[model samples]
Target: MSAMTSAAPPAGARRGYPLIAAAPPLIAAVVTAAVSAAVWSRLPDRVATHVGGTGEPDGFAHPAVLVTVSVLLLAGWGAGGAWLAGTARVPARALYCGALAPAVLLGYLSPALLLANAAADQAADVRFPMWHLAVAAGAALAAAALALVLPTRPAPEGERGDGAAPRTSTLGLRPGERVVWQRTVHSWLLTALQGAMVIAAVLIAAVGGDTGAWIVLLGGAVILALTTRVRVSAGEFGLALRPALLGVPRLGVPLDRIAAAEVRPTSPLKDLGGWGYRITAGRRGFAVRSGDGLWLELTDGKQYVVVVDDARTAAALLNDLIARRSAHSEG
Candidate 1:
């Protein structure tokens, strides 16, 4: 489909988008409140507010303060998320997931914090079990995975290949003319590494009787599975990178913002600081390994690169789309 065809809705029409997209965060807030209330009486008058590197509580605060702060932070987070969801050019699902992931984290942390401090003596320094940290990290990861897999509106109608045959273009394409190139990239090394980590985590948890460790391993496995294989696509909409499992473009560059694009060799370590979804000094990239990929220079002077095979075709199509968009703007 042509990039322009899926242009963002008007501002007036988008006012409600925030409310709808804010549902997850709002639900999270409600869950937080309920959990907090349920544990209120059991919580210590002063709860552990800060933990040192050694996993011991170094500071304390009133339970009321913690709950208030959590609520305020959640509100601010939700508002910011709503704004981003309404404004960004990427898919709403991506925005929703991004926003919801943190909400889920906060939701889990609030109650865990209260429960952890409930048994602490008022006279002694509270020492939280180190395993709780692992649990928090694991919960966050699980939340993120859940967000990624959560269903959203299906891809817009006609986004799939039309009955028309594919055409090639170098300079530009006619209005309604479309070009698409897609390739799936896989990394066996990363997969193996993740598998080893998962195995180690599971073994450790089994030996130590740590549920948190098991959760962390499960979360790690989910993340590894989602990211091990990526599908890169370029069409009228510029460029997109999506995990094969979710089939939703988590990263995208709109054609309107693309100044130029080309296929070029890349170094994941040198150019992008190694690995998937990297942001270096001046460039952002969704890279998996080091190889040829589509590189884009945006109108805002930022650069984006994604490592994928058949990048030559994707780059050509992208440049052509940008040219067409520019010419259309001029005319």
Candidate 2:
């Protein structure tokens, strides 16, 4: 990826939100309150609030309590949306949908709750309305459409730029020289954390008989196994990043696509926005930890950065390879 000499703009500079992007959640909150008020009287004192897999009411709660819960949930969602809109990484469209999703859910589910509880005197008479599901789905689609049409903030200035001039090769490769530099990186802390999570998931699935929990644990295990060790190499062919076990390259930057290479210090969370395989509009990164790394700028204006030890040697080798390729092309 292209590197920036200057630091990022202050968080305060990125805090504004577009009116269209901010309106949906507010509108949804108001509609939820209005609908709740309108149906407050028709709802029973205690409604069949939760249904089991067999389509029977398994739990009951007062309608007022449910409305209160919905209101609280909407409030929490609104606050979260406001916070998310201020962040640079998250897309406005995603924020809009996420913010309004709770309201849309409660809007249809509230009425459905009343319908399900209408014949509370006869428990067997209750049936969920498929129309309510359709209505909720339609509302969600409309919100998503609005989010798509809303204008988004421009990408930040200095997000990408030609980095500093290349340092001389540490490998001392002369013009037309070809050599390879390779290294493997691993993060013990991350691996341990993931392992702990997998164990917890396994235990929960065993005790609770949750097939979904078992699936989640298995997926985590697979990811942990794949990501524990990464193999990175730089040669005349360019740079390749792959999992050690898989041996198949997941990312490759050809000699021609690479404009420059540099070794630079980085913050995993602050710079790359947290660990492995991060993709944004302008750049992609494979960041395992906070430290120095080899950064590459491609001809197409995108960047790829990977955090690893021995970055100085790797950057030098990559630069030499790119220079050799360029000289050969000129001849």
**lDDT tens string, model 2, 208-240?**
434675588668777887876889888887888
Computed on alpha carbons, the lDDT of every model, listed in order, comes to 0.66, 0.64
Q: Which candidate number has the best TM-score? A: 2
Q: Model 2 off-target regions past 4 Å?
A: 1-170, 174-177, 205-208
- What is the Cα-based TM-score of model 1? 0.45
lDDT of 1 by residue, 24-54 (tens): 6667777777877887777776678777788
Q: What are the clash counts of all predictions, listed in order?
A: 0, 2
* Residue 273, model 2, lDDT: 75
